[model samples]
Target: MTAARTPLYEEHVRLGAQMTNFGGWVMPLQYSTIREEHHAVREAVGLFDLSHMGELRIGDETLVQRVLSRDVTRLRPGRIQYAVLCNDAGGIIDDVLVYAMPDRGYLLVVNAGNQDGDFDWIRKHAQAADAARNVGREWALIGVQGPRAVDLVQRLTPSDLASVKYYAFVDGTVADVSCVISRTGYTGEDGFELFCGNADAVRLWRALLEEGRSDGIRPAGLGARDTLRLEAGMRLYGNDMDAQTNPLEAGLDWTLNLEKDFIGRDAIMTSRQRGLARQLVGFKMLDRSIPRHGYRIVSDGEGVGTVTSGNVSFTLGYNIGMAYVPPAMSEPGTRLGVDIRGAAAPAEVVPLPFYKRPHPK
Candidate 1:
């Protein structure tokens, strides 16, 4: 395949992984069975190879609030914010989290597939504003996620991991490598994403594995990653959203600060004022079938839309998917039909986040 392989490629190979291409990278799809791996993360802890994700550091004291569509003037240093990088039309170019480090710098972690594109977009906007220069190829991303992820990570670092809050991170070290451990993850459970120099990835990975062995934390692959994120109700970039859809229609208006003059502000306003033609909603299959993407979505007798994302909820023991449909049909308790294979499969519009957090919300 044309995808790049991570440093952990040999490790995954030794562990007998089913490799697959994801975002231009040859990564592991699953180490064991997807369901077993999925439950491992939900019940305990799991390690993930996230080196393919893009890492960009911002250069400017005011760069944090300046670069993103959101106004982060009040954002403090040593913190992180989940924000969307939008186009001039307000359509999401990519969704990323900004880590405001204490050195008057901000670190941006973007999706692997959108790595180069995200950097280019940010640079264009920053160049137009004559602000925010991107410091390129500086760090590597390593994600250690699961229920006991914190427990395993704390043993490696000298500082207390308890201090880090959800969506927040701090400068720290793992196995003597300079790293930034962020208390964030895509999986439903609590976890951390570490930013370290490229040379130290192997050391960090080995150290984490050594510490997590007894805790049932295995080297999780991309297969578990998908099932885990799907259960969390988090939107996958290209699958759940794209250029044709805006944040408002994707059920992510809360991420946008309409009060500010964002890049896509006008387009969002126009779309809202005109009212949305379609809405994104979650559904549960009433039959024993997996709702794959591109499956036809129908209500009554006609096809309304196509499924953007679909999966069997590993934690909930049900097949689920997200699809765009008429606003009138986007309500809980509404009945719909998913065309699984060539047959119409009965389905229902259930509340989003079909899988619940073990801990109270």
Candidate 2:
């Protein structure tokens, strides 16, 4: 299958970015270097083209409440909540952001790769045939992340950004382009994610880059995005968890509201009563090897679990990764080993989110 190009494709080429195929879309891997981009977001700011993410517009409140793990009725308009979509068997289908629009409908921002499958699954369970609409291709998502992100965007808009609390959104204009200015991000930083029309993507992208030049803003890509998210202790869909993985074992129990009746609630309750065999936990390398996905995790010379996500944390100057291990071995400071080419590279289980942004004064 041919990979689709985003509206910023030409701009990425013009900037000489390294392009790679991600989730059926050709996206920038890095503009200059992954380390540089990573540091830019940590210290200053970085812009991203997130057009490949899927957007589903659903008008049926009943369908929304049935599928989402969180109680959507409590999600007020202009606010967003992070939740997961689960199957009847208590396995996660996808992790998504539920945005309650002012118009009383809901917008689900899902992973690019699972967009089609998610649409099919939701539509299959919808009370009305036209309750869900796939609007991903018609929109573009641009993420401006970092310490200076809010200020950089404030210059281009007349909206009161100060009042736009985190996880909240407002319909406004930026660079004279209409947008749904949302205060949310993946990089564990203070930032805003701007949603605009596909035609306005290039313009919005260029305007942000130009305006942020003085603030040490750089166009970041998937490579930097991965490391930043890892340091922030954020989970990637396919890497951290999947259709076969339950949210309970993934340390996402907070996303589930057992009080409300929803899809997979019964199975999830059953799993809770039955007990989990393994759990996901964070670990840092004690030896000099970098952990990679699918690496075997060992304890007492036995293969115990598998590494899900691993990388060299640029900010901390250490190797960090996440893996699923037995409940007994999941605590911080528990010693373990990562099998690296027949060698047991020593590692220690640690609390997640190796890095956290300092609070603003």
Candidate 3:
């Protein structure tokens, strides 16, 4: 089977990006080095080819103060809301951003791997009831992140994004490209995500590259993306949590609004009340060894957990990871161990979000 190619695949190769397969698509793993690419995003502006993500336009009779699938009704139009799309069992389908457009329609930015599954899920749930329509095929998504991202994109965009509050979006044109720009990102920096169509892909990328040359806007790859999200304590789908784990155990309770009834509400409510048995927690390697996905977690001469996401932090100068451990081992300051092949490295369970963004939220 051949992997798919995004519109920006060739552009990544042209810029000397180290390519790799992600969700059956050839994507840039890194442009120069992972450390340099990660640092560039934290210190300055960085561009990323996020074209592989799936986008949907949802229209309806109008959502209530909050939507059933996600906590979006709490969000106002022309703003961005981070939410999790859940299965009927209360398991996560995908974590995505919802843009309540000023134009009355809504835009949903979903992960590439979860596109078809999520689209089917949304359609199934929304169609079950009248007045809701799923509009996914009409949009393509892109992300521009880093500290100086605002100043760089400001030149091409007509609307003053600075006036747009955090987690808010503005309806406007960038370089005259008809689209929606949102003040949101996954890299834990001040960034914007642009939503457009196939017709505007080339123009959007070219305009940003030309206008952002004065700033440090380089095309970043998925490798840097992993490190950056990790430092920010953001979780990834199919790794950090899945159908077996519920939001309460995943530390995403704040996203779930029990006040309104939705799918899987009863199951989650039960778990929350009964208390979480197993949970996802973050830790740093007390020793030099690095933890990887599926790595065994050990403590007190017993196997009690497994690591979900792991990497050597080029930015933090240490190894960090998130793991699923017994509820007893999840508390901060608890000592633990991780199996790095034949060696069991010393580690300690610590608080989440190992790295903090210096920017004011």
Candidate 4:
């Protein structure tokens, strides 16, 4: 199958970025270097093209409530909630963001790779054939992330960003382009995600890069995005969990609301009652070795688990990764070993979020 190109594809090439196929889309892997772009986001600002993400517009409140793990009725207009879609067996279908539109209805922002399957699953369960619409291809998503992101975006909009609290959104204009200005990001930084029409993507992307030049803003890519999210202790869909993995074992129990009836609630309850065989936990390498995904985790000369996400954290200056281990060894400070090649490298479980942005004074 041919990979699709985003509206910013040409711009990425013009900027001499390394391009790679990701989630069926040709995306920038890095503009200059992963480390450089990672630091740019931490210290200054970074622009990202997230057009590959799926957007589903649903008008049926009943359908929304039935499929999502969180209670959507309580999600007020202009607010967003992080939730997961689960199957009957209590396995996660996809982790998604539910945005309650101010005008009416709801928008589900889902991972790019799972968009088609998610749409098919949701439509199969809908009362009416038109209850849900997959508009992922018609829109473009640009993420402006970093410490200076708020100020950089504020200069181009009249939306009074101060009123748009975290986890909230406002329909407004930026750089003369209409957008859904959402105060949410995956980098664990203060930022906004602007969603706009596909035709307006280039204009918005260029405007941000030009205006943010003074602030040391750079166009970040998938490589830097991965390292940034890892340091933030954020979970990647395919890496941390998948269709065969339940949310309970992924440490995402907070996303489940058992009080309200929803899909997979009963199975999830049954799994809880039965007890989880393994739990996901964060760890840091004790030696100079860097952990990688699929590396075997060992304890007492026995292979216990496998690393899900691992990388050298530029912000923390240490090797960090997440893995699923038995409940007994999931605690912080527990000693384990990562199998790097044929040798067991020392590692210790640590609290997640190896790095956190300082609070504004």
Which lDDT tens digits does candidate 2 get at residues 1-361?
Answer: 9999998999999999999999999999999999999999999999999999999999999999999999999999999999999999989999999999999999999999999999999999998889999999999999999999999999999999999999999999999999999999999889999999999999999999999999999999999999999998899999999988899999999999999999999999998999999999999999779999999999778999999999999999999999999999999999999999988999999998898899942
Off by over 4 Å in 1: 61-67, 128-138
Instruction: Assess candidate 3 and give its lDDT.
Output: 0.79
Write one digit per residue (lDDT tens) for candidate 3, span 270-344: 888888888989999998888999999987667889999999887789999999998988988988889888567
Q: TM-score of each candidate?
A: 0.94, 0.99, 0.93, 0.99
Error of 4 at 87 (Å): 0.9
How does candidate 1 score on lDDT? 0.80
Off by over 4 Å in 3: 61-69, 128-138
Sort by lDDT, best first: 2, 4, 1, 3
Clashing pairs in 1: 29-223, 90-264
Model 4 root mean square deviation, Cα atoms:
0.9
Q: What do the candidate models score in CA lDDT, each in turn?
A: 0.80, 0.95, 0.79, 0.94
Error of 3 at 281 (Å): 1.1
Q: lDDT tens string, model 1, 1-361?
A: 4778777778788889999998998888988888888888898888888888877767654544544666665568878788887776767888888877787667788888888887776666564454444433455567887778888888888868888888878878877778888888888888898877767878888888888988898878888888888777778899888877888878887777777776777888899999998888998889988887788997666899878889888888888888888889899888888877667898888887877667731
Tell me which of candidates 1 and 3 scores higher on TM-score: 1
TM-score of 3: 0.93
lDDT (C-alpha) at residue 308 in model 2: 96
